[model samples]
Target: MTLDQFEARAREFLESRCSRRGPVATEWGSGEERLALFHETTDEQERAEAEAALAWQRERWAAGFGWITGPVEHGGAGLSAEHDRRYREIEAEFDVPDMAPLRIGLGTVSHALLAAGTPEQIATHAVPLHRGEAVACQLFSEPEAGSDLAGVRTRGVRDGDTWRVDGQKVWTSNATFADIGLALIRTDPDAPKHRGLSMFLVPMNTPGIEVRPLRQMTGGASFCEVFLSDVRLDDALRLGEPGSGWKVATSALAGERRAVGDRSHEMNARAMALLATLAQRTGRADDPAVRDAWVSLHSRLQIARFQQQRMQATDERTLTGAERAIDKVLLAANYKLIGDLAAELLGPAFVADTGEWGTFNWNRWLMGSMGYRIAGGTEEILKTMLAERVLGLPREPQEMKR
Candidate 1:
């Protein structure tokens, strides 16, 4: 079938599924969404609710929508990227499932692994990842190596056919529940920091791997700290050459950075609808200031979609590293702008538990806005990248190399 036909059929299938009396869950079946689902429930009830939502996702995977862009040899549909995007558009309208959690695992990590992994490596894990039988988390960030990712001190050493890893990763999303984790660490500390690194797929359940969830401003554990204490992995699990972690991570991060541009488009329609409700409820619809802000918000939302289309029309590999950095900066700024518009329209109801309509649900956006500033490279770092790389400015010499 044509791509258009596939999307149409996918939507029809989703509509039928959404119409059924499926399990009622939060907005996205995530920590942020859990507050909405079990607004007032015991821990046991919330756990059960989360499990039910995950079960729904498994059902969708079985139906073929879950593995749309995955390698067909690995139990995926082996469809083109456009097909997956169209299917996501259809799937988003209904409550069939929320695959945001899988974006890093499947979209970024798995795709990168498939690109860089050995044939035996692909044979062992690619299909399981596509099938949702495995969940993966990125182990990239560290206390001293947040924006300067190459400065990672996490160390790995060769031990016969296996490598031992010891490192600390911070701000790792989904690590607490992830089945497998893709981590970058220093395999040869004596070499230049960037050249000494290697990437490995470490299981979260492995001995000496500790995942501690970090609470956000909104009181959710959306991020975690991963500690690897002499964790070991067979050479078979390595993604690329011994010291090619930076290259591998760059590719994976490029995919991630590319994916960010689509975030605003995902929830903009729903957010706009909610904004109108808030405006009317607060009697701000008549205010000229509010109207102007609303107009600006709508324009930004459209611009985000347009940029996405432009990026899609070209081969992503043709994009410069700077271009990817620009995309990350734009995505974060657009989300913050949207969050600002919401705060203006919704007021303090966004933070306080006022029990007012359209207010309580905004904590997710408020919290997520700040996170956008930090995650995927902080705003400051992205701006520096734009200046140094894109603008062709002189680089500062470092004296600490001794």
Candidate 2:
């Protein structure tokens, strides 16, 4: 179909659901402070957001818009990637419900499963995820294995037809609400760390699994710590060959980095607009030093925006895995920089809540920005990967774990 036809079809579908978004309110001391990097939601509020997002996704699935670029045999529209991009561009014009809750399932989990799952697994688990019938979360990080994924200590011992899992996963997003978890476990202790691991799909409601929310300094429980004790799963739940866990885990991490970059531009743009207003209101707009910092940040952010647009237009096959790290690192640094700018603008007021409109409320954003640096992948780790993989530098010596 023609691009115009595609636009018309998407517009018709969106118009039936919601009206176009009006101009954003940018006035100082107006509306919400909204500076938090992570969502600050009560339990009730979180559930409401989830329900609204799921409802919208289910409708999109029924109308063949949920999985635009997904395969036809897997319950998707089987359209081109361009069609998917165009639909999202059009969808942005309308006031649709936020789909942040479904991002892990759609962006990270589904990509990894599609790459490594069997046909039956794809149809059973991946399809429901794309259709928004169920939510999935990755269970990769452990207390000691945050960035060093190969060091994951979660154990899985085989029985007759089931594997007994026992380990703890930290920093798992959406675990409290996820229906399924893609868990990485050590299946063979005698093999090398990377080779001994395996991936599995565990039903979240399994008998011996527990999810406890981890509250951040920003007072948001966006991540969870999960414990699995004697959790048993059928062999069919295994994602790939016993020793291919590294391959399957990296697939999801790559998707996560790209997704992080894709979603960051808009958030950064909004912060820039708000910070510009903050500067003028606080009389720092005319300061030469403030101006210099603002310009530098602005230039870097604008370049990052252009880089992302170029990537979106380019073919995925032409890109390298190292390219994904660039966006993640760029945005992560920008988030901290923006937080610093906010702190400078607010000055001493940034330390205390004085009931001022936009002053002290920015504390959440600054604290939360630091989390992004460690999320997706740590800054130190990604930079090393870029140096060795992208720049052809000498590899860093790995400390032998004997």
Candidate 3:
């Protein structure tokens, strides 16, 4: 079917299936409602919410909506970039099921498998991911290797038919609940740091794998720490050539950075609206400083949206590593600007647990606003990347390896 035809059908399907008691049927509308419900849910309501969300995704996957940019052979619709963008637009208006935890696996590793895995591996794993039957998480970052990923000490020793893994990974978001992990480990310790690694698809249920949720300042379990001890994986589960794992890992990270840029556009819009609400409620909408801040934030948000749209529009996808740094910088700045404005506008109300509409919530944004910059790559790393790579500046001295 044509892209338009598919989008129309998807919208109709969403309207028909979404709970009427919640928000609109569009993706964002539905997502906002679902997020509110998700955040406010009690332990008893969590399962019911999760099941409802899962069922919604199942329906979309069956109808060819969940995997638009995916390979045609792997149960995705195999549509063009425009088709994917259009689908996301239609999806934003309704409160639909969420799969944020699954995105890194399906969008990144599934594609990586198509690029580097044996055909048998793709056939065995890709379709189940699209159907939301399994979830995947990354096992790259370690206690020692945050931004300096090549410094990871995770080891995978060769066994007769399987490899034995032992390592620890930190900031492993969603690892505790994931079905599998895309682990990168040192298969040849004597080789150069970046050259000795190998990638493996390791089942989370393996006997030696342990997952512990790491709570954030926001009181959320969005990140975790993982311990792998003598976990075994068949050679067939390896991705790419044994010593060429950096290529796979780099490809996955590049895709992740680009995806972050795209998603930030929608997120910025919501942030602006929330700020606007605060401005109007506090009678700050007419203040000169508040107006200037709002305008500045909106301008940056628009530029981010345009850049993201341009990146998606190009078939070759020209968002290079440095351009991604630019996106990250803008996202960080926008978050801080919006948060500051919201906090300022709320004034005395911001510090109190007023139980009012937007009072206590200010603290969440105030604390979490800078998380994106620090989480993905630190601001210093991004600035260095932009200076040395994008602007052709001289390289700085290498720091001591921790």
Candidate 4:
């Protein structure tokens, strides 16, 4: 269908299902921004949000709007990415449940599965994930292997038709409630570090797998430290050919970076609005320094948005690893810029947790913004990749083995 037709249908569907809401109004100190870094919610609140998101997703999927870009066999509409983008634009007009929690599953994990998983694996996981029937998390980072994903020490040994996995994964987002995890494991210690890794689709409920929530400074326990001890997995759960995990991982990481970058524009808009409100409230709207900061941030945010558009225009199937790193770097930098501006605007109120509604509560966004710098890929690592691969710079010398 044409864009107009699709948008009209989407509008009709959304209006029929949910009430339309106006653009968020500025509430000065009484209202919080929509771009939340960490949600400090009770278990009941979290569960209710999750349930609402799932129900909304199911309804959208039943209407053939859930996974617009997914294959028809996988319960999607088999539409173009532009169609998906338009649907999201139309969706923004309604007051729907928050669906941010589904990003890791629907964007990162699902993309990885489509790239490297077998037909059965895709059919089993991707469809449910798209329908919001199942949630998935990435179990890639470890205590010793943050940016250096190839150095992961999680081990998996094959035993006939099963693989026994044992190791610990830190900074595992959404693991506390995930139904499955796409884990990277070391299967060949004798080989090179990057060559010995493999990926697995492990059921989170499998025996010997434990998840412990890690509280963050943002007052949220959204991340977790996962321990897998003698976790037995059938060989059918393997994601790709043995020892070919780096390929699968790089694909997923690229998707993660793209996803992070994709939302940078929206995030920047919200942050800019919040900053403007703060300046007005503090009577600093006329300050030259504040104006300069706001202008600089707006320019940088536009750059980030342009970068996202460029990345999207490129065929993801053909995007090189280095090219994909650009979005991540831009996103992290934009987030840091927003946090810094907020700090400047709020001054002392930025650091302390006053009982005020929007003033001190911004600490969550600042802390979370700092974490984004290190989340998908660290700034230093991504810059290194860009310099070496994209800029024709000489590679950093590898340390000689003792």
Candidate 5:
């Protein structure tokens, strides 16, 4: 289809389903403060949200808007990347499903499948994920390996005709209701750490797999710890050849780094808007100190938004390591700055039991902001990566073995 034809089709579909959000001005200290970086929802709430997201995605898939850039064989539109970009721009103006529920499935898992999954695997798994028949979550981080992803200890012992997976995965989002997990497990303990690993599209409902929600300081369980014990999965579920997982894993991680930053722009904007309103409501808007900090945080957020946009505008194939790391670091920095400014504006309101509109509500945000610094990729790890990979600095000395 021509560019104009695709744009027309998307606009027509969105107009029928949802109204346009032309200019939404925030009411001072009112409306849903919804300033959460990590969402906390009960099991029931999560199921409802996931269902809504899935229904919308399925509708879109039926309408030919789902998986706009994915290949036809994998149930995508088989269109150019530019077409996918255009579809997003058109969809942004309209009110639609939250889309958060399917983010990993489509953005990271599906992309990894395209890179490493066999054609049959893509048809059976990735296609359905985009079709909203299933939801997928990343099960890469483990208790022992968060930043050092290769140090994972999740083991998948080969048995005749199947593999038995046994290990624990921590900090997994959407594991509670996800249909599948793109899990990385060690298949060869004797090989070098990175070379021993393999990736799998593990069915979450397997008999021996368990997902336990983790309560965070924010008083909500936004993530989960998953345990697999003797859970047997078909060999067909393997994402790539044994020992090729490192390559497959990097493809997924790179997609994740790019999408995380791009997706955070709106959340940060809502937070900054709330911060500005809090200053006004508390009569600190005129204070020069508050004003300076607010402007600084706003400036930082704006720069981060631009960085995210620029990164998004660039072809994924061309993004350098430095380019991808910048947005994540900037985003974390802004989260911290936003929290600090909110605290300054909120005085005793920070911990007050009395429910003030914009006051105590920021408590949740503050907690998430601090935790986010270490989530995704830690600022420390991303910095070291930039130093060594992009700037050609000498590597950090590895500790000598005992």
Candidate 6:
């Protein structure tokens, strides 16, 4: 179908489920506007939002618009990526619930499953995730293995049909409410660090699983530390062949980097727009330094956009690991740059939570900026990848012996 036809169908589908709303106009100095980097929702509020989003997704899935670019056998439309992009364009104009909470499920976990899951596993999990009947989280990062994912020490010992898992994962987003977790565990400790790992689809409600929220500087407990103590999983839950988890994790990490990069561009644009409005509100729009900063930010945004388009156009099979790392590096740096400019614009107000709404709220963006740098991959790690892999530089030497 043509783009217009697809959009019309999407519009019709969305209108049937939710009210049609035009793009929200940004009003200068409106304290009611949301400018937080991370949502500071209470547990009740987060649950409500997640439920509403899931319902909307299920409705969309029922109408054949949930997974536009997903494979046909997996309850998706099996259309081109452009078709999916068009649907998103149409979605933005509606007053539907935000789908941020479902990103890891749909973007990362689903991709990982598709790459390495068995046919039965795919049939079981894909539809539920696409329909938003279930949510998933990544259990890759650990306390000692944040950037060095290959160094994870989570262990899973095989016992007949089940594996007893015991490990701790930190910075696990959505664990508090996830139905399933895509976990990496050391199944073959005798093998090399990278090769001994394996991936599994673990039920979050398993008896030995525990989730503890970690409150951030932005006053949001969106990140959590997950403890798996003797969590038992049937061998059927394993995603890929034993010792093949590194490959599965690489695929998921690629998806994660792309998702993070896309979100960074979007959030950076919104934050910059808000900064422009703040300048106008404070009568600093025409100031030379402000104009320079605006121009610089716009230039950087354009560069980031170009990089994003390049990444999107390249087929996933043909894209190199360094190329994947570049998008995230640009994205994280761009977000930090935008946050710095906002601080320069607001001065003291950026730091203090004054009675002002939009002004003080920028603290959310600034505080949350650091987390983005570390989320997909740390700046230092990505830079090293670019250097060694992309630029043909030698790998950094291991740290000197203590």
Tens digit of per-residue lDDT, candidate 3, span 201-295: 88889998888877666676567789888888899889999988888887777666766666666556666676676677778889999898888
Clashing pairs in 6: none
Cα error of candidate 6 at position 197, Å: 0.8
- The lDDT of each candidate is 0.73, 0.87, 0.73, 0.83, 0.85, 0.84
The residue-by-residue lDDT of candidate 6 on 1-402, one tens digit each, is: 787888888888888877877545566655466666677888778888889889988888889988988888877888877787668767877788888888899889998988998778988986789987998899999999998999999999999999999999999888889899999999999997899999999999999999999988878888899999999899999999999999999899898988777656556666777888888878889999989988987998898889888877666778766787888887777777787888888889887877776777777776777887898888898898899888899989988867
Per-structure clash totals for the candidates: 0, 0, 10, 0, 0, 0
Q: Which ten residues in a row have the lowest lDDT in candidate 2?
A: 314-323
Cα deviation at 379, candidate 1, in Å, is 1.9
lDDT tens per residue, model 4, 1-402 = 788888888988898999987776655654545545656665556667777888899999888898988988877788777788778877877899988667788888998999998889999988898887987889999999998889999999999999999999999877777898999999999999989999999899999999998888766777789999999999999999999999999989887887676656655676788788888888899999989988887887787777777766666667787766887787777777787877788899987877766677677777787788889888888898899888999999999999
- Scanning candidate 4 in windows of ten residues, the lowest lDDT window is 29-38
lDDT of 5 by residue, 1-402 (tens): 998999999999999999898655566645776756787778789888899999999989999988888888666898877788788878889878788888889888998999899889999999998898999999999998988989999999999879999999999989999999999999999998889999999988989999999998878898999999999989999999998788888888777776777667667777777777777788988999988887787788878877777766777677655787887788788888888888888888787847666678778778888777777677888899988998899999998978
Residue 291 CA displacement from its true place in model 3, Å = 2.3
Order of the predicted models by TM-score, top scorer first: 2, 5, 4, 6, 3, 1
lDDT of 4 at 333: 78
Screening candidate 2 with a backbone cut-off below 3 angstroms (N, C-alpha, C), the clashing residue pairs are none
Clashes of 6: 0
Question: Residue 338 error for model 4, in Å?
Answer: 1.7
Q: Clash pairs of candidate 5?
A: none
- Identify the leading candidate in terms of TM-score: 2
- Backbone clash tally for model 4? 0
- What TM-score fits each model? 0.83, 0.97, 0.87, 0.94, 0.95, 0.94
Which pairs clash in the backbone of model 3? Answer: 25-94, 26-93, 26-94, 27-91, 27-92, 27-93, 27-94, 28-92, 30-94, 30-95
The residue pairs in collision within model 1 are none
